[model samples]
Target: MAKAFASQGDLEEKKTSFTEIGRGLWAFTAEGDPNSGVIIGDDSVMVIEAQATPRLARKVIDEIRKVTDKPITHLVLTHYHAVRVLGASAYGAGQVIMSDKARAMVAERGKEDWESEFARFPRLFQGHESIPGLTWPTTTFSDRMTVYLGKRKVELMHLGRAHTAGDIVAWVPDEGVMFTGDIVEYRSACYCGDGHFADWGRTLDRIAAFAPQSIAPGRGDALVGPDMVAAAIESTRDFVDSTYRPVERVVARGGSLREAWEAVRAACDPKFADYAIYEHCLPFNVARAYDEAQGIDTPRIWTAQRDREMWDALQG
Candidate 1:
């Protein structure tokens, strides 16, 4: 029998947790769902990574109301992914920010991605009708941009490419905490369908160089200390390396995608089998890694049709 496409089989809702990684900085994480970061500035708050729909985004807003009543003034998107950006309208922030490259990607393939993701994981889009349309950033920066919420300074920097070509991290200099989008995940599978596998490790190195005391990672639990921070970074690197190396070896031998799938599962399953979204991410990760190993510099856009075609091919 053919496997379910992506996360279509995943219908059970995950328990949500709101963790304080630093003073006034919170991480809103679901079991293995996409995570969002909250940075409570002196006068207002800034949210990173919107949920898939406005209804899910409102859950984060509800969590925010518990700690402080400050208005959400900024919504900073780390990259252009359907799950992360489609909920922008709910925030009603004065500014919605993304990297210049990310904005370009939205213009290029955002609609197709939205359609693909909605089909793959219907559970995330519980309130699909509430989503107005594709999320666009009102402001964009090339390399780095800094915004001050009164005395607090939050720096948004486009670190090297990893999860996607335009991935960025929000660094709170005063608190020594960083909100790394998908560039770093804590025990959660990295979704690499649109990733740059070759550049991912270097990006991890750049993140480690900062030695952040705390981190609100893209998924899983929030890292609250140097020990946990370092471990999560290294583990993420290991996950990326483990996934790509076996596929690269298979590609070098002129093995087919089916062979690469087997190779990746053999290498990754023993260790990452229990991780969040491991099964959902494996097929996409293998496809991208196989392409990258064969000298494909850019990941191909995945429409709903392409997603099913790829899944069907791999099932064989």
Candidate 2:
């Protein structure tokens, strides 16, 4: 059977420049679109956060080709989301790296997430059929690990749960630049289908501690300078807090999902209404928040059918 496109709205798939941050570090970002980072070491290249598909990732590869022909030695998946990791095969890297937790998510709920995300944002999956299947990491780590591309050192750390249980960030200490997958978004909505609200806030705090001069967030424009980076983190924290707190408050007052959704909308709509993907993310955000507020630790699976059912129930 042919798969259906996910989003009903229009999206532009524009090409963007690869901005150089340090001696060998670059950020590839489309205007308000998913962001990917590149680190060129003495010997090889490491790409952080592959795009939605091989066709889309080729655009990034094209940019990388401009600088060097160094083999893409590593493709680091910051998390297990289909939009992020499915492009791994396109890189043809010898090692696909990820957190053990992230690999587990792929093993556990990858198929459901693939279906759910494809249904929600079709444009992101531009060449969906080209995807080999769910991306599985060849190398997995628990806490932290360091990889050297000749002399440059890239540190991968699994911070506390935020966007997902196994969310990881790539820190280039020498460059003072960080690649935070979906843990921090500039002007984009933080998708919370599998997020931990409370832990998410704390995770932001941990990211802030790095004091990155520049940040290439999971989506949206890259943040430059300390002020912009701080603002991005705070804005992301505010979005998560604004979405989760109101829902939690309503749940405390014995509110139904509809009531909780209303409360969340009332609190978040005014401030975050203009953010990218806010409309698409709100229903799932509220559902996850509601479940957490009711003491559900792990998030439930979101199938395409369940996505629409929840959206209709809460968004109505």
Q: Which numbered prediction scores highest in TM-score against the true structure?
A: 1
The lDDT for every candidate, in the order shown, is 0.93, 0.88
> Backbone clashes per model, in order?
0, 1
On residues 199-278, what C-alpha lDDT tens digit does candidate 1 reach at each position?
Answer: 99999999999989999999999899999999999899999999999999999999999999999999999999999889
Q: Give the number of colliding residue pairs in candidate 2.
A: 1
What would the TM-score be for candidate 2 when compared with the true structure?
0.96
Segments of candidate 1 deviating more than 4 angstroms:
none
TM per model?
0.98, 0.96
After TM-score superposition, the amount by which residue 70's alpha carbon in candidate 2 deviates from its true location, in angstroms, is 1.3
Q: How does residue 80 of candidate 2 score in lDDT? A: 92
True-structure lDDT of candidate 2: 0.88
lDDT of 2 at 177: 93
Which stretch of 10 consecutive residues in model 1 shows the poorest summed lDDT? 307-316
